[model samples]
Target: MAEFTVNPLRFDPYKNFKFRLKWDGRYVAGISKVSALKRTTQVVKFREGGDPTISRKSPGLNDYDALVLERGVTHDLAFEAWAAKVWQIGVAPGSEISLADFRKDVILDFFNEAGQLAISYKIYRAWVSEYQVLPDLDANANAVAIQHIKLENEGWERDTSVNEPTEPSFNSTSA
Candidate 1:
């Protein structure tokens, strides 16, 4: 039987990511994307006969279809699939990637440009939960806080903590 291998993957903002293989020198012929929500089974099917293709199509979801078909140019996959596309592009140095870094980079590189303010945080949390990357919120929270702090240093701050109080409006008390 030919060797079949798959490993953790990611995509960077500059369109670089990697898919690791189990074998010592198994080169990737190509890669594909599928949505986790559509798959009923956890098993991933590898194309037989020394081919490197992932076969699993996500079901038709309204939001997913809208994103894919936007502007009459199909994005080719849902957001998760887009994440996989990032992962596919990362298949170059053959090293394991930090999911946290992936989240942050994807945010700074792609999401931020799209005018999505919370996409980074939302997607980061989802990836962390799904991949079991960080066991506790403390770790991820620290990382996110660092990101925010850096942004603040760079003059980009958004008040989200709700710790800051708003000035009370003063109207005529006895009017």
Candidate 2:
């Protein structure tokens, strides 16, 4: 198996920050951090030589599986890590228009279109530093977001039950 890592990319005023992909072959593409990890990693297989008509094979799914097996994590967690990394970028604003800002907008758009409402809403709230209602998109985001929320809620319930005291029987007469 070939090892692929992302080098910290420079802050570009005009273009998105680009990570250097050092795999078996040198394939460089400037990807937004989230796209780099989530989408790109999955379909970016093979260093060089594939037709555009075909999709790139990526280690993303493999990595997700590895993480699930190794750490017993959900795919949402794994993909979120990739998405978070993609969203983290240095910004330099030239005349109030920043590439980092543009990348963030694109990520939000993708997140919305990809049916990641909960995640997207959370990110927006955190970034904006406010508590606001999240916009409801189509069923796509609703499905994925509900899945994530359900998993998270289940995990919380499991942990809470584990820590809670069991019910005890009491005598009929209590002083």
Candidate 3:
């Protein structure tokens, strides 16, 4: 069976440049970069008592890598707010951390070249583990100030509900 039923003619894979991150029911602005989603499972090896030479392997715990989101420095307080939930420097005794609503589920949406929604993935229980307010300043170098946040997520799965969209074609006639 063909993988892309809607766009069967598409031979090239989707590009990584067009993507958006959404949380708190709204899209996050200035998300320039996002780390790859990766997961690994530990392999458990065991040897039978009778068959000493042979070893069997089984799947163990699964570990999901932390996701890093980067964007140009702006006045937005979304990143700072989320990071503060995990740990804050100044606050009353133990009220620094927002334990009640720290973790959040974020949606990553990938768009096609025509700005159509192509795919999406739902990150489960993601919480900010690290936050970078500003990048190193250089007097001679010309670059945008980038801020980033590292999110520790329990797991993530592709949003199967978002299927391959029917690509649009524009027809132009000569004047």
* Best candidate according to TM-score: 3
Stretches off by above 4 angstroms in model 2 are 1-133, 137-164, 168-175
User: Candidate 2, residues 1-175: lDDT per residue as tens digits?
Assistant: 3333322332322223322221113321222232222212344555445565655565543221100111112342432332333333354433333234322211221212222211211111111111112224576553422211101100100111121122234579868
lDDT of 3: 0.93
Please give the range of 10 consecutive residues that has the lowest summed lDDT in model 1: 146-155
lDDT, candidate 3, 1-175, per-residue tens: 3254477778889999999999999999999999999999999999989997889999999999999999999998999989999889878888879989999999999999989999999999999988999999999989999999999999999887787888888999999
Counting only residues 3 or more apart in sequence or on different chains, how many pairs clash (N, Cα, C under 3 Å) in candidate 3?
0
Model 1: per-residue Cα lDDT at residue 73: 18
TM-score of each: 0.16, 0.14, 0.95
- Note the Cα lDDT for every prediction shown: 0.24, 0.24, 0.93
TM-score (C-alpha, index-matched) for candidate 1: 0.16
- Output the number of the lDDT-best candidate: 3
| Candidate 3 worst ten-residue window by lDDT | 1-10
Angstrom error of the Cα, residue 135, model 3: value is: 0.9
